[model samples]
Target: MDRPRCVWVRKADARVPGKLPIVYSKSYAVRFHGLERLHPFNAAKGKHIYKALCAEFSLAEGSFYEPEELTKHQLRRIHTRQYLRSLRWSLNVARIAEVSLMAFVPNNYLNHFYLRPMRFQAAGSILAGKLALDYGWAINLGGGFHHCCSNRGGGFCAYADISLLIVRLFDQEQCRVRRIMIVDLDAHQGNGHERDFSNWDTVYILDIYNALIYPRDNVAKLSIRSGAELPNHTEDATYLRQLGRCLMQSLAAFRPDVVIYNAGTDILKGDPLGNMDITAEGVIERDRLVFSTFRGLGIPVVMLLSGGYTKASARVITDSIVNLRQHGLLDLSPL
Candidate 1:
């Protein structure tokens, strides 16, 4: 039986004719009473990358795709209603955010200043997934909220953007995208999506993470179709070799219609959380390998900027994106 095209996939607007398939929004910045300064993690990563891309790629403000905030209805598609409601509580949000001060902040400012940016980023992920199908590749300058699942939100992730993107694509582009693969290269384990898609054969997860880090859900490891758990301080060679092998093995095991690459720079040497020794050049090469493997096979790929804690993380990510362009893995020329 033929399937009808789903309406959830946003149609391309005429405003972005010369723009590449890069999804971003000014709202992606989490600015609230200078409280973003309190957190060690960089909250304005999307804005940093946007500025870098603007300077490097010769892009204007309106050149990128601006994603509307994801309404509760959209998030409810993957996340549980209880989980969504839990976000309204300052205590719950603070814990999920790993910011103690967030608990003191009132719900009005909490919801508006902090979670709203996340919603925009989450929606950007969904938009990127849709754009990837039309173009060969798409990049959501913000997103990769892998720490949130259907029933839970942890680590700094309040919404399961990865899960939502795949589910939306499955529900919308079902005929063309019957199967999708999540290549989570973040330094921390992607237990959220792992738990959400557990026992689901249609979604294959390839999570290469530092097994020693946070949310080391041994149970969630069961869902990974193929992946690697590196020890603390694993270097570039070992990391990339294992990644190459994993990509080859996962592709051989599952012929996916689309690939979701969680490109996280937290794996860099100085990152306090990632606990790995991968250099900036190593990070750039890592992105190239992932993009090459998927796009080379004619599979649509969506790149999400996931975990990156250090101040230099944004520069690393921006350099990697430029590397992808230079290597011909990402041709941002308007389709």
Candidate 2:
């Protein structure tokens, strides 16, 4: 007696004959008039990355996958009813978004203007997870909302896409995926997933982050199977060494059916939020290292864009994708 497969994955919402395994959508942008400018995040981050991929890889707008908006029932798979209801209040949304003006905005328009983008990105993450199982690698231009867990949302993360992706994979049983490893190198601890999978032996969390950053969750630190606490303004050599050692050690201890790489560019130099001094080249190599490692093992990998406060994050992400292509890690040759 086998479990039912995920119907969502059976449907074709992600790829075409020519499209790569990358996932993205135009609706991923947060366009609340000029209010989005308040946050250091570039509202058009997904769009810019899409354009860059198009230029570099010669892909068209149609070549990318556009995910459907996640329904409330779908969200309930990971988020509790109480947490979901809390989002109805504009005040809570304002706090999560870090935008005070959102409190005054009409609650009716909140989902249409702001939360919709996040929901779409969440859906994209699920799609990417399924695609990774088939293609060996998949990249969602938006997602990695790691700060939000099952019962809470914070640090500009309104959804627990990471948890949902793993849960969906496990529940669906469409992809023989039981042991999942999360490699969160986002400069801040991924307390959301940590809290959700605290005692789950199947989920291995390897989180490398700054010790002095936001959401310094001591409780969540206990869940990290292997990670490092970096000092402020840690440079390339030290960061890469720590990452290399952690990856090698964790893989030797735990074997995962799938790898979720939270490729956050906030660790870049001059990032006001991440507070690390890793250069642009460091970021590129960081992505390459993660991709090459898991892909070399014949294990499927899914990469998600998490937190990057600076506008230059878009370019850095674009360049990194190109580097991945150049290194023969990303196969746009239609697998």
lDDT of each: 0.89, 0.91
* Residue-wise C-alpha lDDT for candidate 1, range 136-161, written one tens digit per residue: 88999989989889988989899999
Per-candidate TM equals 0.95, 0.95
After the best TM-score superposition of candidate 2, give how far the Cα of residue 47 lies from its true spot, in angstroms.
0.6
What tens-digit string does per-residue lDDT give for candidate 2 at 1-335? 23355444444443458878889998999988889989877778888899988988776668877799999999999999999999999999999988999999998788888999999999999999988887889999999999999999999999999999999988864547868999999999999999999988889999999999899999988999999999999999999999999999999999999999999999999998899999999999999999999999998899999988787899999999899989989877772
- Off-target runs (Cα >4 Å) in candidate 1 are 1-16
In angstroms, the error of model 1 at 100 is: 1.3
